[model samples]
Target chain A: MTYCVAMKLDSGMVFASDSRTNAGIDNISKFGKMRVFTRVGQRVIVTLSAGNLSITQSALNLLEQRARTNPDALGIWNAISLYDIAGLLGEAMREVKNRDGEFLRQNNIDASASFIVGGQIAGETQRLFQVYSEGNFIEASLETPYFQIGEIKYGKPIIDRILTPATDLTEATQCTLVSFDSTMRSNVSVGLPIDLLVYRNDSLSVDIQQRIEDGDPYFSQLATRWSEGLRGVFVNLPKPDWLTPKI
Target chain B: MTYCVAMKLDSGMVFASDSRTNAGIDNISKFGKMRVFTRVGQRVIVTLSAGNLSITQSALNLLEQRARTNPDALGIWNAISLYDIAGLLGEAMREVKNRDGEFLRQNNIDASASFIVGGQIAGETQRLFQVYSEGNFIEASLETPYFQIGEIKYGKPIIDRILTPATDLTEATQCTLVSFDSTMRSNVSVGLPIDLLVYRNDSLSVDIQQRIEDGDPYFSQLATRWSEGLRGVFVNLPKPDWLTPKI
Candidate 1:
């Protein structure tokens, strides 16, 4: 299981993904799922991947190979728009599917994956897209403002209640981490060593990236404070006043 | 779509359920899912049903008819333990399956249902059980003191974070409402008019039953306060320090 969330606020974009993969309970291990593509001052594309690790890794490898061999080809760095880069990523996914989808189907494993791709090209505004396994995609708008992939339900209510297009970049990052903490606490398959990246709109450069593991003091403080705050609220709600008398 | 939760704590028991049913998106309706059976000084058994409303309703009707015809013949009122009542409910479920399971399966509707049954007998302590469609059930022991059925994942994180056997009955009820509110906010299929039943340990009667509807002042107040409290916490959490020095 994986949990990755990305938000496109008016100020910037925020991306966070957990680093846990498991074929089964006994075979769990760490694998970071955030990939950064940049051609400094030209374009910066950040993607969060979830689902069958082999499929995602192969698709990513295909994308990297294309970037290296074919500079004039439609690649993330050279794409005219974020939409075009999303299309290129979808093309890579289909290529990987052609290579390995049949073998996975033969073994009864579904050839499935989901990706959240968000960043900016040199001439375009910052944008975000959720790419599906079928090589189709949808872009986020002001109304939706965010995209989440994998193990989403346990953490959805908070995001639905707290985030909006008007939210600031730093506040959006805080909300994303709180959402991740809720998911990580409820699920064993989503473990620590989280990757978070913040992209300031129109910067076309990458710098604000942090890798958080257990014992990270800042995350530790936020998690503890949130828990204690909830407990306090739970203790303060009014009890039932409708307990009628029974004969 | 439904959200029903039951908790067995040292102080007593708490049950909360939403009251919305829909065959499809266009045919949604309201129906009570919580049923109460009380023999006043002898036994009190409350059952909350979810999934395949027809199957559960038929099962409950069968149990009611059996009690009418022969009050002493394995009725909930005279069952020896809460466990016996859970078995009785399971038996009723199997009987319903035997009668209509084939027709429903042919029509492409599953003959599946889930029930949360709990209360106390005269000599027994408070107990809780979750009965399955196959007429088998599991009890909530000290290790895991709660059970939820239907549309569970959206509401699960809060309960997982806050509930324990040592939690007081009133606090347990508050937590259950919070859980239900979260589910309701995330899903339009699960709606209002919540049914809440509170049983103090060793009180072999029903008194603390509240049918909370939309516009109930106390519930409305609690819900508003909880939402505000969460937003407050989200705003207060410290922003990432590592975001500094971005180019």
Candidate 2:
């Protein structure tokens, strides 16, 4: 399982994805799911994918091959808009599935994969899109400024409460990590070594990118402090007056 | 859809269930999912249900009729332990499914249902059990102190963070309400009025019972206060120093 969240805030964009893949419990392995495409100072496209590793890897490989072999092919690096890049990624997914999906189905393995594709091009504002397994997609808007894919439910309530279009990059990153922490605690399939990238709007390049593994100082402090703060808040929440019986 | 949660705590037990049901988006209605059976000062058995409402209702009706018509039939009131009552409930579920499963399947509707049965008889200690649709059940223990059914994932994180066998009844109730609040916020299928019951361990009778509808004062206060408190904690979370460029 994967838990990747991306927010298209007014200030910038925040992307985080876990690095765990498993064919089954015994065959679990670490595979970073964040794919970064950049033409430095021109465009930066980040894709976080979930589902069958083979399918997603194949789809990404196809996109990368296209960009590298043919610069004028209108792929990730040269796309006019984030929306066009998202379309290319979805088409790549269909191409890969059409090649391998039948073989996977014969072996009773699910062949579907999805992606949270978001970033900025030279002329366009930062945008976020979640591409479905069927090669269809939807873009995030002001009303829904964030998109989460894979193992989303356990960590959804917090994001639903704290995120908005006007939220700053730093705060959105904090919220995304908190959401990841909640997910990792509840589910074993979503493990550590998160790939995090923060894109300041209009920069047209990536600045802050780090892989967060176990015992990272700031993440550790934030997680422990958040837990402690929640317990503190819970203890102070007023006990229902009706819980006590009049003697 | 429905959301019901029950915890087996050392101080007693807490059961809370939403009152919303829907055949489809346009066919939503309110029907209390909680049923209480008490032989005052002797036994208090509570059943909270989820899944196909018709199947669960029919199963409960069968149990009620059996207990009422034949005092010597060894039904819920005279069951040796809560375990026996859980088995009875599971058996009732199987009977109802066997009767209605064919028709529902023909129409492509699910015929499955489940129940969280908990409480005590005169000779037994407090207990909780989650009866599955297959007529199998598992009892809650010190390690696993709670059970939730239907629309459960959105509300699961808070309970995972806070609930324990050692938690007091009031605190457990608060946690359950917070969980319900999270669920209702994220999904429209689960909503008020919530039927809440708190049972004091070994009392063998229920004292506090309330149908908390919309505009209920304490619930409203808690929900609003919880959201505010979470925002407070999020702001206080320290931003990573790495986010800043060394000037």
Candidate 2 displacement at residue B49 in angstroms: 0.7
Q: Pick the candidate with the highest TM-score.
A: 2
**Model 1 per-residue lDDT tens digits across residues A90-202:** 88888888999999999898779989999988878999999998889999998999999999988899899989998887788888888998999889899799999988888
DockQ of 2: 0.60
- Cα deviation of B133 in candidate 1 (Å)? 3.9
Cα RMSD to the true fold for all candidates: 2.3, 1.7
Lowest lDDT sum, 10 consecutive residues, model 2 chain A, at A238-247
User: Can you tell me the CAPRI class of model 1?
Assistant: medium
Q: For candidate 2, write residues B48-125 as lDDT tens digits.
A: 999999999999999999988997897986888899999999999999999999999999998878999999888789
lDDT of each: 0.88, 0.91
How many backbone clashes can be found in candidate 2? 0
| Fraction of native A-B contacts kept, per candidate | 0.69, 0.63
